[model samples]
Target: MQGYILQIQKIKDEDCIVYILTNSSLVKSYRFYGARHSKITQGYKLDFELEHSMTFLPRLVNTMHLGHRWLINRDKLFLWQQFIRLFYEHLKELNDVEEIYFNVLEECALKLDKQNAKRLFIEAYAKILDAEGRLHNCDFCFLCDYEIGDKVALARGFLPSHEHCMNQNGFDKDEIEEFFKTKKSLNLSDETVNRLYNILLDGF
Candidate 1:
């Protein structure tokens, strides 16, 4: 089966503990000589088998990296890693999550090389919010509980707030509404995208 390596921590000798997110679950497995597996890192996808022993932790074996061209670019890879870690924090406590979670990552990773990572970051986060049933209508202020006027500020999770209510001038309301409806960060400035993406780092 295939899974994304969310995290790996070194143990005694070259052994390590790995946390992986597969289509249906979050898994913790062991790997001896893990240091030798340079391609197995946060944000990299691997196809592998897990060995289970009654008295021992599950073991990772027969791994193959499904590499991406963007991963070799240090900046792109770093952003990808940062985006991937959000899944670990969000899904770590659950034994199972909706397949949409994994699908969102898969879809986003495919486009990482083709689009601006920040744009994809915000758009991917919107996908997650939608899948989880939290992408609310954006016509009102999340804080002040009033109709939003010309512009809207986004709190974490993209809940909309009126710019005046927020004491901040925000992205154009139509653009934000369009983004929520379409899941595209079209027309959002790089500066605007960076702000939205930063909110995502605070986690869903």
Candidate 2:
């Protein structure tokens, strides 16, 4: 199916919960604004139906209601839809948090020869992972083979994920390709970059 623009807000808390906020009025009015006989009551009913029936809508709601701090924004819904399609459907990529945390540290470490940068990277990973565990309230971590606890960072849209699962999935590859393609090229450690490269070699 063709993707449509959607106005979306992606909220992230220290505790890894991502919330999506949107202006529902615009969503409902998009198609029926010029429909014959469209009235106030009909608009309400249509809004109710569209919000309720769409599978992705509920996920956004749950994120907002549950998370302590929510990320909020108003943007074109088409861009949101495009992001979802690219990350979830086409490449099965991971989220922004993971990319930033790992990429930034890796870049700092290699280009500047900074061990502290690597330390910060690992630290950030732990912090975010802890937040993910706490928010989801599950100890079982997918990235770590052992059920270290009850939390597994279920791959949500626009969030970071554990390093291992990021590799097992295609997120790492997308990160590398996208990173190199960007003008501000990344400085990834040889081992870390090679690991990602090997995964890409294996393919999905």
Candidate 3:
């Protein structure tokens, strides 16, 4: 199967535990390091085979790195690694995850070099929430269960609350509402994108 290496944990003697995000699931595989084996880096896409082992995790072998033009750009690559790391945290505990998670990463990766990383990150995260049926209508304040005012403080998953309720500055009601509906960060300022990105880091 083809997958993106989300994270690699080094074990004894350079062996490692690799967490991969594939089309249908998050899979963990073990790699036995050897001089003949190519090093695997996080964020690299690979076409690989899994060798089932009786005493260990599935063995990763015969790997071929899928070439993406963005890989050569260090700045873009760093952003990709940082943004993709969030998926490991968000999905690590889940047993059943929708295929949209992988699709979101694939779509975002294809556009990373063409668009602002913060904007792409926000949009991709919103897509994840939408697919999970957690992206709610941001009309009422989740805290008070009342209709919100001109400002809304969005929690980790864009759960809207009145600014007074959250005791923090809120986003403009109309703008945030549009963002929720469209899942597009193009209309939002970079500052707003950064805020949403930080909230995304909190979790899925």
Candidate 4:
């Protein structure tokens, strides 16, 4: 199976608990420490086998690291970690997460070093919200139901609002609309993009 390692917590001596997000599920497994044990860490995409036992956590076997070329760049590595940490935290509550979630992670991991990391993250997150049905796609303000004008503001959960409703201004409605329609923010200014990304950081 292939998955991204979301977290690792040290247990008793020579043991640890591993949280992994696979293509279709979130899994928690046990790792017995050993010199030969595959080196696992948060945000690593790896291919491995699992040895399931009746009474113990599934054991990871024959782990192989994949798509780690981004690690060679310090900036990309930092951004990649931040991206995966957010992804893991957002999906931890669900056991049967959609496969699109994993595919997004893989896509982000591969493209992290290819473009502006912040831009890549925001685009990927937009797709995630769309996939999870959390993206607000209406023409009216989410807060007041008023028609959205030239400027807009985004609230937590990516809900669109009139700039005045949020006591903010300067976000172009067309750009946000394009983002919702295409999951891409090519025409948005850096300031607007960062504002949207900040809303995401506030939660969901």
lDDT of each: 0.85, 0.29, 0.85, 0.80
lDDT per residue as tens, model 4, 1-204:
889988788989968887789989988888888899867777888888889999988987888878666688888777677777786678878788889888988888777766787788888888888888888865789889988878777787778888788887646777777888888878878987777777767656
| Alpha-carbon TM-score of each model against the true structure | 0.90, 0.19, 0.93, 0.89
Q: What tens-digit string does per-residue lDDT give for candidate 1 at 158-181?
A: 888877666766887787788888
Residue 39's lDDT in candidate 1 = 48
Ranking by TM-score: 3, 1, 4, 2
Q: lDDT, candidate 4, residue 31?
A: 82
Clashing pairs in 4: none
By lDDT, the candidates rank as: 3, 1, 4, 2
Best by TM-score: 3
In the range 1-204, model 3's lDDT, one tens digit per residue, is 998888899998899999889988888999999999998899888899999989989999998898788889988888788877888888887656678888888898788767887788888888888888888876798888999878889888878888888888898888987988898887898888888878877777
Regions more than 4 Å wrong, model 3: none
Say which candidate scores most in lDDT: 3
Error of 1 at 41 (Å): 0.8
By summed lDDT, the worst window of 10 consecutive residues in model 3 runs over 89-98
The per-prediction CA RMSD against the true structure, in angstroms, equals 2.0, 16.5, 1.5, 2.0
